[model samples]
Target: MKSLAITVWGMMALPGCRPGEDGEGIALVRSLPLSDQQKLCLEKMVDTFLPDTDTLGAVQLNIHRFLDKLIANCYPEEEQKSFINGLDILEGKAQDLFSKSFGSLENLQRESVLLGLDNEENAEEKAFFDFSKEQVILAYTSSEYFLTNFTNYEMIPGGYDGCVDVPEVPFKV
Candidate 1:
């Protein structure tokens, strides 16, 4: 199963599944029949991880969809099932710790939770948490926000002197 999963993932990684194309942004999940819990958890995950940058956030990039595809097509059955089930564990813990649910945790609270997950001493949970977080970052950065806002390339160019001294203006006209 692991081998099969790996093979499938390799295929998916072959550039055809580029993170953003057409209109298949992060909105794909919204069109699907996700459970209420899954929806909430995804929303929480997005809100928690996304920063107000010029680049695309995870939600805009449809990372949840990518993740779904990865899990269904690439992850070993056990790992995929474990993650499907374990999402609740993360969500429940976030709610218990923050008292506002994972979706509702304030920025500081979410940060604390994410940091705690990252710092776990448990080998298994730590590995899974780190994997999940890495995916989250990937999804967010590849999103349209990052693609559009983080970069600027002008087709036209003008030559400017590499070294020039500006005259100081004495008055603030």
Candidate 2:
């Protein structure tokens, strides 16, 4: 019955989910406000937050791009602008500290820059950094690599039980 319902809903949703004109997906990518340098800075920022260890990092799982798309698609326009501005703010910090872009900073410098985002001088930077940390953690934990290897994801949620009492009476259906 659940499968039947899903099929019905899928069929209903199929028509509204058509692809773009030129066999493209997410044509909104071109429309996104971020420049290439900003995207690179974002990648560097997320990587700095979750550097590769024994396991792959957030950037390895494409969390940077996922974040970009998330902010572009899900956040309200006002929020999207704020986040972009936050990126600019970080860039400015990098320039002020290292005389270079955030993407050009060393790993330690990147770490320092990100760690200092919560200064009292700007409320926007604090809000943006907090939201960014939350989203990066959320994306990392939910990635397939983290789930399948680190936490042992269970698709249907079952476990083995050693001692199980059988039904006293088994009635015929």
Q: How well does candidate 1 match the true structure in TM-score terms?
A: 0.57
List the candidate 1 regions with Cα displacement exceeding 4 Å.
1-34, 140-173
Clash pairs of candidate 2?
Answer: none
Q: Model 2, range 1-173, lDDT digits (tens) per residue?
A: 99999999999877656776876553544334888888889999999989998889988999998998888888889988998898999999999989999999999999899888965367888898899989999999988888888886977798889999987897799
Best by lDDT: 2
Per-residue error for 58 in candidate 2, Å, reads 1.0
Please list the residue runs of candidate 2 whose C-alpha ends up more than 4 Å from where it truly belongs after superposition: 1-31, 159-173
- Cα-based lDDT at residue 167, candidate 2: 78
Backbone steric clashes in candidate 2, count: 0
Q: Candidate 2: what lDDT?
A: 0.87
Per-residue alpha-carbon lDDT of candidate 1 for residues 31-111, written as tens digits (9 for 90 to 100):
333567766776666556775456555666677777777666666778776666556666766877877666677778877
